[model samples]
Target: MNVTEVISPTVKCRVHLHVHLDGAVRPSTVWELSRQKKLLLPGNGSLKDLEEALQIRSPRDLAHYLQKFRWITPAIAGDLAAIERIAYEFVEDEARRAVLYTEVRFSPHLLVGPGGQVTARQVTEAVMRGMARGERQFGVTARLLLCCIRGMTENYDDTLDMCTEFRGQVVGIDISGDEASALDVDGSVNAGLLRAEVRTFQEAARRGIHRTVHSGEAGPASMVKLAIDEMKAERIGHGYHVLEDEELYRRCVSTGVHFECCPSSSFLTGAVPLTETRHPMQRFCQDGASFSANVDDPAITRTGLEDEYALLRRMGFNEANIATMNFNAAKACFLPEEEKQDLLQKLRQAYGVPGCD
Candidate 1:
């Protein structure tokens, strides 16, 4: 069969595992929310203003690029209704992109009103309410990962307490932020914070909570090693530098540490080479390193789960490779073994594989 035929036949089976809910809010929706809330705009009071605020150009570092979210927050802040709507919309968009399952991460601590009155527990409840609504509306299954910002280690206790409050709703805890800012080799301000963060991760593991760390996104292989060895991360989010360490790469491959690869975000942030052919995702797959392509920020990157899959196809990934990638995601999911098996079987059946039932 031709490439087109193979891809078309297998598209239904593919699942995108990595997604960020807060980062996936539609820009137009944000603008509408801002207008409804009578929020002031820094620029001209129009959708163009919102777009300009979210627009990220090349050569801008990750920290600077992330700063754009401050402008968009006003659009979604203090509105549980808007949060529910955006959450539903995000899941709907994922379903449209043929995603069967997703694990979305968001920092609940950062979501607050102008008075800073909203507690972390309230934030978690609102997000869970949104996700519950989305699951009911869309067939796509989703689990939330409550993330703790790297620099905000002081809030670790509160974040963990919030996670416990929404225990059933949250599947994991992630330590995510500007990797370059957090993982300094020299004894910097965040060094002690990083050590404490590892202890928090260990505590989470002891409490039977899944843990993943955003490591090596902008740093070296040593950072990735630290996440695996010290933090005991079940998965490494955007470990782009892991390829530099041969031994570490082998350990990851043999130990089955999933790498949540966000192609558009990596390209935009200059972590991975921008060219489709030169993207490290292909090499990582070829080397038996398990990973799944994800839309890190649908709104900011102006791309979705389907766009990432399409990009991979254009980069010469075959249907079989794509199927394997989806399987890797399914296997690495935080869901129960029975649920994972059911999904894997469904995926195999969709691909017309014999004996799937």
Candidate 2:
């Protein structure tokens, strides 16, 4: 469905708190990187054609969805210049589409160059440089969230250390991979990976760092509970399944734990795993679990926040409901108080007006 048919892209005031650098690059950028790196990607003709070719098409599960990164990682993952450019470009892309605030995430470990040439610290610093430039240029304020592979606690420690090293440049931590993959049926973490995730969570808490875990998207509702109660996350990425568990639902609503709901990514990851007209988020909306509409991996899904908001509108959300989601995103974003207040004021002007309601 065309996004403009659902809502005028220019009219819909927007905010994005969940986006990934690993998946936000423009196809034109990827094609350029591939050419520079001497890699032959699966496409012909112009950058537009390459975009069609590079997309994941239809991934059925989290593992399947992750494989699409293979096309992205080799070209830019290890290159410092590519990392910086991608960061800068992501914010610029969203800024054109009216995103006032965004949170872009990536795994520094994934950028390890061949032959031990590049360090995660170097890569992360380069990313910060690029993002700062993007923010300055576009007026789209952004923060970085470092993600680690799930069940890889040492990876988490490395991520945490990067977060500490970067200080204010980094906003939070997240663990990717399916939440169920790292947990036992009893809700305990597996031996090695479990220990590391727990330790990293503790250290992040001690440091007063923010956290938002990928949970309940594909895992059981209990995974969301574990993320909040055990890991002390302030936000839950794709915690759509929480609606099935009443106690968990009550706790999430009462605690006001924000859910970063990405409509397109939900279908791609098999989180919703259905073809119904209703999106998974409708239930979350009905239950009053706070959420923000996101474009989880914009490039991989070949979509932007406009597409997500379009889907929400098709599924029966009015402009006011979508603005509510934007408000949730702006409030939960890891921005400085002064900057956040500025955004909140902008949102008030954009959303509080007559036609928006």
Candidate 3:
């Protein structure tokens, strides 16, 4: 849609968090890389065919939503050039969508070669290089968040080490996967794996790295509490289910623990119930909760920050609500205090928030 051409510079000052680098890779890029590498295609092997295969048309559960990655990951995984290209393009896409500042997250272990052909350090450096170039050209500030995938305990330490090594560039850590699959029907997590994940986050907390966890989306409210209490999560990713527990919901609202809300993804992943009643975000808005709108996986969901904001508008969000969310996002961002104030000032100027200037 060439969003860059349409969006005016005045409104291009929003803050975004919770987008995945791998999930946002351009479809055409995936098509070309897959064909060059001779990777299998879904249908006729054309770019259009690959695009159709990469996007999830039918809304499904979290597991089904995640399966779409199989089509794109092989095309870029372990390939340094492809990884860098995707990371660079991600910034361009966000800039077009009016995202002034964004923190893109990914699992470095997943990007490494199947046989350890590339190191995690190399993968992170390639991403940093691409994002740095993109920032220079596009004028959109970008940062990194290294993710630790659930059920992959071996990679937890490496993720932390990478975050420590790239402290300024890599601002925080997250654990993302199928939240439902991570817990049993009774809501208990795997003891050993949970312990390992907790240890990584504890160390991150001790080391002064910011922490966020993917919880309460496909899982129960208890999972959200566990994330904050045990994993030391300062922010939450797709925390729609937090409303399931009144105490937790109240606590979140009172404590101002920011929720990275992905409206389209919440629906596509079946995290929120499809109903005519008010959406969780509406409740969040009415309750004055600390949260921000985000695009979880743009390519897979076939959306961007603009699409997300439009959906929120349809769901009854106003300019003030969106502006407040952006302010919340800026305050919740992992940027250093000085940079954060700068971002807030920019937002205040852009949104014309009174009494700040």
lDDT: which is higher, 1 or 3?
Answer: 3
By TM-score: ranked, best first: 3, 2, 1
Poorest 10 consecutive residues of model 2 by lDDT? 3-12
lDDT of 1 by residue, 129-231 (tens): 8778877776778778888897788888777766666666687888888776664467232556477788888888888777888887777777788788988
Alpha-carbon lDDT, every model: 0.76, 0.80, 0.89
Each candidate's root-mean-square deviation in Å? 4.3, 3.6, 1.7
Cα-based TM-score, every candidate: 0.90, 0.90, 0.96
Please report the candidate that would top TM-score against the real structure: 3
Would you list the clashing residue pairs of candidate 2? 153-196
Q: In candidate 2, what are the lDDT values of residues 1-357, reduced to their tens digit?
A: 754223234533688878889788877788888887788777564577677765667758888888777777888877889989998888778776788777888888888776647988888998999999998987777789999888555566678888877778898888778676776778664544466676777789889888988888888787787788888898998888887788988888888899999988898888887676567688778876689889988878878787788888888988768878888788887776787777788877776654332
Ranking by lDDT: 3, 2, 1
Q: What TM-score does structure 2 among the candidates reach?
A: 0.90
lDDT of 3: 0.89
In model 1, how large is the Cα lDDT of residue 86? 77
